[model samples]
Target: MAAGDPNHVLHVARGIEPTEALAVLGAKPGLIRTCELPDSKPDEWTSLPCAALGIQPGTAAALLAGRIGEWTFVYDDLGFTCDDSATMALSADGRTAATSVFTINADASLLYAVGGEQVEWVNVDDLNLEEDLPGMPAELRAAFEAAGNVPTEDLEPGEADGDIGMRAACALAGLALTLEDVRRIPLLVVPFG
Candidate 1:
């Protein structure tokens, strides 16, 4: 989508302030005027960040993204959100978590599970992606960059509560990591039959 592409234009709805709502879709300054509005929230906005979108108790997506280029894929009532790669820690309650969303299948459930990676000790120097799009922290991004296996236990205690938080998961079989080093991996707790 070019700066002025038609499909790339902001899709605003009533009370959504057509010209002003473009920021919610990350459109350029002048591009606001070129928006082709929709009757409701755009189909592209899968899951927006509640904290980043300024979601109030009684507010809806329309009011939320009216002016905010809302962060999507954040942990919410929605289950199991993550970046492109399924790397990261889980919530204390054992839910699949992420700083953003990917191709999420809404019906799937996590029974009792945790995340792990084939690699540990990710090189802290090589991770570079679209930061402007919002994502997980660099520390968690680095821990999974090494050569190894997954760790099902003892993920170093870290923070997986809010966006940009981390929790470590130490290696179990051959995974070499400290408590503060496991956030670089993706995890969940799915109950097995």
Candidate 2:
């Protein structure tokens, strides 16, 4: 929930390149900015001060994206609120999964879309996996079930249940970020409106 930590994680199905994904998210190609990940471990990238990357704290909207196996993962430090129509557009051709968490306001949601249509939207924090998991997409439900056993074990201090659920959804959507994966992949930095 820190300033530079990811607040929104979006996954677009494989075959959609980072630029294309950004286009879907409303980023203008000419206006977009690019930056290389600092010469540091991948895990350290998120923790690095935003100023190091020229991101104005609490003002600029930037997105870092990279392809990972079956999906392209887009990480945003500031929670970019996309409306339902835009969310559906991002998944027009294939599948898309988006997870957002804003701990300061206790707000979070996991959204799944396929072929330009929304299939699921879950208020992660309010979910009681035991009662709601069955209605979610199979992959997401399974992840949530797996995460239910040890909710806060892997989380940093002060993280909420919503963070756990959001992470589970992201992982299920092929966003299980790892140091090596992050290191080898060059993320595209796109300036968002």
Candidate 3:
């Protein structure tokens, strides 16, 4: 949106290189907020470079206007709980992963079983719209609704542990990125399968 508005805004970016991703997403050069993630133990859901995006009035409209397709990942801070942040990971090779509750299905069991898994990449626009939203599992829909439109200041511990988080991680790895690179980012790798 407008520069220096002090309201939360979405960063719509794509590309493998971080700079390119921001450029493709039409990012404005400003001090957008970001969270720092510490090192995690093995078998943990690490962080993304850009995790939660602050949302304000017109945020949704901004996102829609700037969309590069479903290939674009949307991140925002949900006010209800401390753990409602989400985003997507774009790798150096044009591969992408999503972790936003709006992007991935957050099923605990599905995540545990598919952790670290990878598959062929697909364009977000190629997805069958008829089979997409209506086909979302009940758990995913509930999580999406529970993480309503609000921002929070509460701090919660631990990495994002859930099916959605794992799905994002797997999607990141699917991009053929190194674990070291993956560990440094604050994005959520939304799974396509």
Instruction: Give the clash count for each candidate.
Output: 29, 0, 18
Given candidate 2, what's the lDDT at residue 192? 63
Local distance difference test scores for all models: 0.23, 0.61, 0.29
Question: Candidate 3 at residue 146, lDDT?
Answer: 40
Off by over 4 Å in 1: 1-90, 101-125, 128-193
- The residue-by-residue lDDT of candidate 1 on 1-193, one tens digit each, is 1111111111112223323323323324442221222223222333222222333322322112222122111112222222223322222223222222211231111111124222222121222223311343443334223322233353333212111111122111123433223222321111101
lDDT, candidate 2, at 30: 83
Q: Evaluate model 1: give its TM-score.
A: 0.16
The ten-residue window of minimal lDDT in model 1 covers: 1-10
Instruction: Judging by lDDT, tell me the better candidate of 2 and 3.
Output: 2
Residue 182's lDDT within candidate 2 is 72
- Candidate 2 C-alpha lDDT tens digits along 1-193: 1343455544444457778877777767886555565555234334222433565555665667677776776666665644666657767776665544444465666676777888887775566666777688777677666554345775443333766555665566566666556756766776565
Where does model 3 exceed 4 Å of error? 1-15, 32-169, 172-193
